[model samples]
Target: MKFHLTVDNWTVQKTDARAVRFDVFVIEQKIPVELEWDDMDELCIHAVAYNEAGQAIGTGRLLPDGHIGRMAVRSTGRGQGIGAAILQALMAQARQRGDTEVVLNAQTQAEAFYGRYGFSRDGEEYYEAGIAHICMRHVFA
Candidate 1:
């Protein structure tokens, strides 16, 4: 199914936009519940992509420092460029917020995907809930 990506402050719709993506990431993918959510959620802006039926298939969030997180696309919907769309929307929103650098804790396996968007690794890899992750940053001057 195809999707329409939308960027919005999580508050405008709150959990309404993130529920499904979290289900895939936190439950289906086995990412720890604590790792899936954090205190920053309420303070950050969110980006969501809705499939034709209006269900969210992809989602991500941008923190105050322009760090993006929770970038997840439903397993059934993977390999369809949804993740790229989510990242693009989130970064656009971050730029609007006066941020010139966009950052994210990337799942090591997916670092290459982000690299295509001009994001480069910032430091050594680390373990987050048993999964390897690394800090990546996208800077726009």
Candidate 2:
């Protein structure tokens, strides 16, 4: 069945966004709460995606330094374009703020996903929160 979804910018404290990230990162991915919740959240621009039932199913954030992180889409929401929508929203926010480039530490498994959006892997593989990751960057022309 097809599902309808909506993506919107929200404050860092928005509960919907927090809930989505909590489920995807902390619970599903086994990331520690301390490492998952950080001071940078207050200094970042956040976005959340909601399904037709108004349930938040995806989330992401763009930091002041042009770093995109905490990207997550609920298992039920995968393959539904929610992740792409969140990424696009964050990138638009960066472009509007005059950022010349954006970067993210993509979990190794997701490198190909970001690559589809013009992000290129920039460095050797590394581990963050016990998961393999690679730095990826997208330069705006």
Candidate 3:
């Protein structure tokens, strides 16, 4: 049940190389190709996790504006706390940068998952790429 978390710039770019995991959660999951990739990559910090075999099992990215998104743990790696570890890693990076807050767009189904990290929903649910989504924000307390 113990998972190690690491945060670094462009780390995910190396381990999650092809970003196939992202394509699974973002593009293949129909989360709008636009939302899948943005200009943020150039300025964001990425967190990537490696399993016992040294393969990328989970990943996430944090933007300079405190935007935490594009997080995904390979399906096989689920239920091992990798997603939360990735989020926490990015949050730590944000804190190191003196960010006072963080924001993310949560798919309706995962809202509760993000809520555990102190994220609060800000608006009504809306459809994006045929899936329901809501804006969520988290502020340091």
Q: TM-scores across all candidates?
A: 0.91, 0.92, 0.86
Q: Write the per-residue lDDT of candidate 1 for residues 35-116, one digit (tens) a residue.
A: 6666787888888888899877778888887889888888767899888888888888888878889989998999999999
Q: Order the candidates by lDDT, highest first — what do you get? A: 2, 1, 3
Q: What 10-residue stretch in candidate 2 is worst by lDDT?
A: 1-10
C-alpha root-mean-square deviation, candidate 1: 1.5
- Please give the distance, in angstroms, between residue 103's alpha carbon in candidate 2 and its true position after superposition: 0.2
lDDT of each: 0.83, 0.86, 0.78
lDDT of each residue in 17-39, candidate 2, tens digit only:
78988899999999998888877
* lDDT at position 98, candidate 1: 86
Runs with alpha carbons beyond 4 Å of true place in candidate 1: none
Question: Where does the lowest 10-residue lDDT sum fall in candidate 3?
Answer: 11-20
- Candidate 3 regions off by >4 Å? 1-3, 11-20, 26-35
Candidate 2 ranges beyond 4 A from true positions: 1-13
